[model samples]
Target: MKKSISNSLLLLSGIIILASCHSKKQLVKRQADSSAVRTDNAASAVKNKINAIKSKQVSFTTFSGKAKTKLNVNGNSNDVTMNIRIQKNQKIWVSITAVIGIEVARALITPDSILVINKLQSVYIKKPFSYIYTYASRQVNYKTVESLLVGNAIPELLNENGKLEPSNGNVVIDGQLQDLLYKLIIGPDLKVTSTDLSNQSAGQSLHIDNSAFVQADGRVIPSEIAFSSTVKNKTIQADLKYSKTEFDQPLDFPFSIPSRFSQVN
Candidate 1:
């Protein structure tokens, strides 16, 4: 009788241990399945956001705006008023005025060339469009600059195969362009909130933040833009706040370099 009782207790103990191990395994499996479901849902959300942005392309022949601009280069800051005009892909004209409302510099940017006239110094710069890249990242171009001004994603990033994930209540798209790593943060409304581009090899990075959106011509436009860049141990920052803006209006872009101004190399 004693032997039978001991045998029965051992059998019961073995059964309990096996059941506990099986329960643990089942719990782990369930957790993994739940995690995968969450991942799939997040990915689907990102895909939908990307498609929505691609569908709504702001169509306009002309864009113009007035803004107060603050520029800081190497700790020196200057406040100025800016008048900007854009004729689609053809031209971008900008005039910079001082506190007295006197225009001190004007710039005209085209697809192939860039022209600038400085009234204060009596100098003009005429160079290939690539020249602007010297002051900015190598990926800087006409479309990139225009997109930055209007708070849109660059064509390269949008059209590329990128990895999308959710972070801090925003969808982030990450990709590489021209040997640079780029991250674009998109808000819930499918508008881009900020862009970050980094070139690890050169130790350079560019950050742009857009906010204060307003509806114009059935599209949302950013009213404030903050730009910061670091290149070769030097940093420059610019803040632009738009006071007035209009789109799809017939506009004129007039640019003529003063003949007497010396050309800068």
Candidate 2:
């Protein structure tokens, strides 16, 4: 069970990637009236729309939240509690606990390295950021991970390649970056609602949905978030509901590796 929780927490930090788009057709082009001129680009309004969506991302110096997580990895399902803390663009801390508040695992991630301690097994893993990215997607960076955790749009999608399309009340942007095709949906209030990413040749795809929203720390964010991803036979899905959250609070990141613990590569 500890191993499963370890895998769950480890992948939770790694699974968030900027590769979101449904299909080439959903994102690329849509049917247009014959009399109307078509211009995916070449419109200044397109830039304004993208910028407005970016401006809605949450801004904070420090954040803390406790989430009730339902996690399924490799067909094994588990219910656990997650205590998450983030110091803006600096570091992210996470603690996973089971029933009776028994802490089974803890992890700390930074821009340069990653560290994990499995209390149940007396083992630890320490490696560079590349180690986790190798299993997930290279497109995922520290900033994207931080943004996704708080229901913010991934910065990668707002680049020059982003093509804004005509939509109703919500804002939608889609484009292709290398082999990764991407799309982003922003709610009427300018918060990110859904993100989809796919790579047909690589047989990889991922989706994240923010089903509901609420006021947290004076900012509106997704109260419930769901993630579903598949790569070949491996499947991972998780749903998180924020039970309590705070922002800009004084916090501590306590990490001291015990000598008795063995380090795993």
Candidate 3:
């Protein structure tokens, strides 16, 4: 009788394990369905917002404000503070200062090219703005640059032109923690997922919301930006307040390649 009882116990344990596995599978399926629904909803909302922003007929005059950026690459980190100004024809001026040394760098950008003047080195480099991604060390992405200027992603700015078609890729903003990606294709959607923000000292994740508002000049811009990113195991955060915007000012591109400076390809 005792031997029979032991065998029965083993059989019951096997059944329990099978039941647990099946339950886990069901949970995973439910989670995936929820995620899919969330993505669809976010995509739809972004489309509506884009349409509304473009429907307005006013041209913005000028926009200016302060911005801060922090980057972490393979454990090394740096912080930068910048003053940004933009004009209506997509002319942009950005003055960046390093946080540790206060080393100032200036960049002037037009629709065609970008000119970067390094005050610390007293040198200037001219290239296509898109090329900066390939050359700069510990450089931020173009999307970050757009965010710094207008609290919007680069693709959103392009969407305003009605000629620039969105791409079919997603960017991992603030690194892998938040799992948020902006889908430029399909419908230019902003999809957000879970991110680690608990350890502020360890660089919290960043979450970008889809809710943007039009400025007084009728240009669509993000009113509130939630910035959370981890850099060098350091928790840094800021609520960037932007105002006093002006758009459509004329900016003469004042960058010339000096023969004296060594050419860097």
Candidate 4:
């Protein structure tokens, strides 16, 4: 009887041990399944957000906080500041001022053409959109400026068939061998995410949270945009703030040149 009792006790111990081990395995499996479900939910949310942005017909005014490198007779350095404006339907007119001892530059862009009237030079350079995009990277962020002119964001709005993935923490949109999506989230008061666009080239990144939001001409506009770019080994940063924004105001889209500004390209 003593031997039988001892055997029974040993059998009970073995069964308990096996049960504990099985429970642990089940717990691990449950945890993994939960993690996968969460990941799937997050991905679905991102896809939904993209769809929402695409479905909307949005008109907005923007304030920009910009940092950009100005290559000049002097040397390379940083400039930052605010610009304000209203933009819609591939047309924008903005006056940009600077901080850090730099002068303001004013610009107007349309779908077919871009007219940049320089306050410092007292000169106006008008050119086609394609020509400007190819040659203008040296002056401004070619991708961002192009998107504003078209009233849409690239890759987000243009590269509809690009690869979307999460890198680090931010979502990256990549196009055939070129990465066209980059953005930074900022925190402060104004609460905005600034973005840098390369449109398939190596680009820049920057952000400011407390930029500005302004109402203009019956529409809401982002009163500030912060930017960063790398043109060579140098990094350029900038802020653009718009004081006035107007939308649905009548102007020629793909604006035609007055004879005075007309020269066949």
lDDT of 1 by residue, 163-241 (tens): 8777765667888877789998876656777889888887777788877666765667666678777767666676777
Residue 215 in candidate 4, Cα distance off native in Å: 7.6
Query: Model 2, range 196-251, lDDT digits (tens) per residue?
Result: 88776766778899755666666767777888987656678988876777889999
Best by lDDT: 2
Instruction: For candidate 1, give the lDDT.
Output: 0.64
Worst 10 residues of 3 by lDDT: 16-25
C-alpha lDDT score of every prediction, in listed order: 0.64, 0.74, 0.38, 0.33
Q: Kindly list the per-residue Cα lDDT of model 4 for residues 78-122, writing each as its tens digit.
A: 232223233433444443334445433445555565555444434
What would the TM-scores of all predictions be? 0.80, 0.87, 0.44, 0.46
- Measured with C-alpha atoms, the lDDT of residue 121 in candidate 4 is 36
Candidates by lDDT, descending order: 2, 1, 3, 4
CA lDDT, candidate 3, residue 243: 32
Off by over 4 Å in 2: 17-41
lDDT of 4: 0.33
Q: Write the per-residue lDDT of candidate 3 for residues 137-240, one digit (tens) a residue.
A: 12234433443345334333323222223234321222212322222211222322211222233322333332233343444444434444333333323333
- TM-score pick, better of 1 and 2: 2
Between the candidate structures 1 and 2, which one is better when assessed by lDDT? 2
